[model samples]
Target: MGEQNPLCVNVSTTNSTTEILSRYDMINWVNDCLHTHYTKIEELCSGAAYCQFMNMMFPGCVNLRKVKVKANLEHEYIQNFKVLQASFKKVGVDKNIPVDQMIKGRFQDNFEFVQWFKKFFDANYVGQKYDPMEARESTIIWGGTPPGPSRIGHNNKVSASRLVHATKPTTRKASGLDSKHIGAATQTAGGAEGGGSQKLEDLTSQVSKLKTKVDGLEKERDFYYGKLRDIEVLCQEREQRNGKSVGTEKILEILYATKEGFAVPEDHVEEGAAV
Candidate 1:
């Protein structure tokens, strides 16, 4: 999880004289090593060293739970177990007394550590609770006031909203002359006016060129459209001629039947059959 949500592992030892690490110290260690926050401790495991350590850090935390200890050396294991019991007693962890009694003389497998901790956490977990007022005050202290809007002129202090709604300032003459000083401003005004007129002429020329191009395009379009119309008229005329030829062939067939005894011309018969 993120730095704000992290898994916490509490290790304790049997040595009472060893310096005890605090919750904040443990958190700093976790952040330095794992780059995660130690917001809430979820699991507690006991051993000679771990029990001593946790007892010192969280002296009377009821949430601390015991896990089965594994050791290869039987004598050392017994010693560690005794140390854990002593540490628990020193920390006033009376709630775990029943668990200690039940798991006494029995060693939990190292492989089942994860499963054991999962069950232990699920059964005994409690979220950290904080006061609303304290939380708000802490936030205010840590996160100061929000930044103000950016300034424009040295004298003007406009807000962001006002700046968005403000209109752009119109361009003005550098000299700021008025009608009363018309004669004095004449030369400069004439120069500016002459430049503006030149620019206008250039724009008009460009417009004229564009209009000529559009007219040329329109004329070309009309030329193609006229050609298409002529082709359509030719097709219609050809279809009409074909219809008249068919009618003529039908009349020739009737004439041939009337002259049944007389032999019809071979060319005329072929032409009528083809039509």
Candidate 2:
């Protein structure tokens, strides 16, 4: 709704012939334009950056309110893409966003689309300054523990340590009391330790279960990655036999790509900040 008419409406017609932008160039362009710290193109798969790009080019067209900037799960990533696709339709951009391939976090699919987008952005962006963090601040859902592996495990370990500390028996200077009372106190202390031991065992079991679940997920991920790699190798051989103009060349690029664009000097690399 921000801009009813498309600005660079002619950009799409020439997109097929648009020169392939290098990975290093695209990465820097995206990071600079979006004020994001993405070193890898695959990180763009979350779709938040793309949504923001549209909003930057055509303000208010993309509902920043709908994008989950901190999305990690596949479904959450899909939601971000949905917002992006809707915005594209609204703004009259006819680009075919390969959401299916892009969401897989594959470099090639994302690279191809991002390359086209950079071309689109270049033609349309009028060099206006936009702060992506400020634009997206309202849209970030605030309550979850940060995205990554096992904050759960860290939390469980901390809780287990606290439980053990709280349940530990402390020795007291004996006030003169009957031996019976002393024995009773000892029995009560022993019972408390027993209860603590049981609770500790329960927590241990929970932690073990969590660990097992994580391992299984890792194996599943490896399995799919291996399959994708196999397919890439197969396609590569066929492409070589058939020559470089194979129909699936773009698809193969998506599979074959493994590097994170170009190398940044060790001193020049900027670390990503937390959202």
Candidate 3:
């Protein structure tokens, strides 16, 4: 069978939204905030919408030109996130962007982060009527191409030549791996060196893939842990105010059992499962 779509996954954990906002509610909130047409929460992974969000809240904080609005590759996504993170730090927003998990477009992780961001937005937004499209288009780069010369201005406009030069990779002069030495080495041990280089590359690729998988798993674990912690806090608050009922007791038992190294009673487990 094929792998499940991340966008299609209906996350069933305790919602991070205070008002128990549904997926559609969060999606709509994002769309409304950024003036976007995003249908799925996974579309936020590009980080473009987020940059505009920051720009909306804190004007001139994010350089929209740096944000890749149509990021398709992982590296492009990273660049967009880097721009977002820099904007956050610049504006003293003490939040970490989970770039690794977000780039993978996981529903749960992305949704949780977006939930937190929405709360932050509510707290920080100062009832300003900001045009997202204007802000984005003011410095937007389209389809990996820099703006034309006619668009250059004294303000936020970047020259086309500068943009092209920035994107172009610099050529580094090799010390020992010069073409003359390479030819001599190739004549002596060409096949052996080529095979060794291929093997090294393969091993590096495998290591990178494994590292990414580990990062995703760690992010998932932290995401679930945070949800449980939120639930625990809510339960504690409820118990203090209204007192615990059967449902609270069973849920608390499961949560406490996780840390106390004790087994939950089978009957309580079954009851919680049924609930």
Candidate 4:
């Protein structure tokens, strides 16, 4: 199975140690060719670059599991794992193994990767197959959604204070509600002039009503007093025409002695005309 992988050269024995040494020579040659090729695959896995060279190399030929180094300059070593066994044989050397059992391992599943302990492990294959966001969670790196072409995740909630502003009303805490009564005299009541004018208007209306009532009473009193003055004038005119009045009496004649007999006036008048 290791021979079919092609990352390592297939070697067969000639029953002579000379042919065994020939296999060693083939292994060294193959390691040199694969050296750069292995590095190429690694750069693709670690970068955003897609694996454009996957077609040229054998599938999974960083040996898939990296424990078998594809290129080791130290020993001139490379790993050759079997890929397929065909009864339809070719000129190359290989081992016979079933495809099903060999293909069982996956490039996904971090638990399997930890167990693998292979260098140059599948990154892009591992990351895409499992979510990169999910992979990041295994380590200290924050797991998050990949950005779009705009380099921003859809549905990401980031409240940027610089870009936005505080929505609450911008009032100073020192400015408290003014509950003071304002009507009598204050700037808030449109100054003292406004309040005083309204009060003066009300008082003027009351004073006008009181003056109207006083005028009506004075008119009635004047009418009664004029009638009393007319009555007193009529009585005085009647008193001037009579002696004193209709019931007037003479006090002097009555006091004298001439009035002792029937009437002193009758004596005086009758003596003159004694007959």
TM-score top scorer: 2
Best candidate, lDDT:
2
Q: Give the residue spans of candidate 2 off by over 4 A.
A: 1-10, 13-16, 138-275
Kindly give the stretch of ten consecutive residues in candidate 1 with the minimal lDDT sum. Answer: 139-148
- In model 2, pairs of residues that clash are 108-254
* CA-lDDT, candidates in order: 0.33, 0.61, 0.59, 0.26
Tens digits of per-residue lDDT for model 3, 106-212: 55667888877777777677789887778777533221211112122233123222332322221122222244444544454445475777655665565556556
Stretches off by above 4 angstroms in model 1 are 1-192, 244-275
Candidate 4 per-residue lDDT over residues 209-243, each given as its tens digit: 65566545544543443333233333443555763
lDDT of 1 by residue, 158-194 (tens): 2222222221111122123233244433444455575
How do all the candidates rank in terms of lDDT, highest first?
Answer: 2, 3, 1, 4
Model 2, position 67, has a per-residue lDDT of: 83
| TM-scores of all predicted structures | 0.19, 0.48, 0.45, 0.20
TM-score winner between candidates 2 and 3: 2
Ranking of all candidate structures by their TM-score, best first: 2, 3, 4, 1
Total clashes, candidate 4?
1
lDDT of 2 by residue, 1-275 (tens): 48577544536535567876666678778877666655455667788888999999999899888888867666788899999988888888878888877776766777778877877887788878787778887432211111232111343343322222232211111122233444554555566575776655665565556556654554454345434534544565576578676466776555434445643333211211222
Pairs that collide in candidate 3 are none
Q: How many clashes show up in model 2? A: 1
